[model samples]
Target: MSSATTYESTSSGHMCDMDRTPIRHAEAIAARNERDEVYAKEAKARELLRITKRKAEKTKLALRIAEDKVYKYRQALFLSWTVLGVYFVFSTVFGGHGHMQLHLP
Candidate 1:
């Protein structure tokens, strides 16, 4: 028999024919190309997700540093105010004790 008309018989007495048509080969190639395109798109999406996660982590670190600086500045301001208040009280109570002997002619 010619190659075009060749068929193989299965163990169950079924004839299996090979498809040698150009249209069938073209369809298979198109299906494979579509699968490759889908995989490429998935890879691009994963890359973008990784980049976004890195940026988010950097932003979070910067925010944490800024918050720490603000907290330290607040503590320093509170301490400065406490010291100033204590000095003011001491000066008001003792500033005139040593100047009581002033006389006017």
Candidate 2:
């Protein structure tokens, strides 16, 4: 329901001359109300789309960070295993049972 500030309201609703065409007061109000409803729905939909996009972006960023951390963890694990293996090999080879000597390249 809107105001009848046009000073042409009857017993039912407001009346005004629109584009040189006479229209029913109820029809005019209904058209205006329908347009308002459409605009509101569109605005709400756009807001929802924007929020969803933002959430997706944040989720993607978090996933990328987690993947990077896992990759670094795997690399470090491999390096530690390699170093330990080398230490054990040198210790066993030179531990008096084998009596091996190493020459640097």
Highest TM-score against the true fold, candidate: 1
lDDT of 1 by residue, 1-105 (tens): 764466666577665546445667898999999999999999999999999999999999999999999999999999999999987777678884355567879
> Candidates' lDDT values, in order?
0.84, 0.81
| Residue 105, model 1, lDDT | 94
TM-score of 1: 0.71
Question: Candidate 1: where are CA atoms >4 Å away?
Answer: 1-20, 96-105
Cα TM-score per model: 0.71, 0.67
Candidate that scores best on lDDT: 1
Which ranges in model 2 have alpha carbons more than 4 Å from their true place?
Answer: 1-23, 96-105
lDDT by residue for model 2 over 3-98, one digit each (tens)?
333445656754545522544777798899999999999999999999999999999999999999999999999999999999888887778435
Candidate RMSDs in Å, in order, are 5.5, 9.3
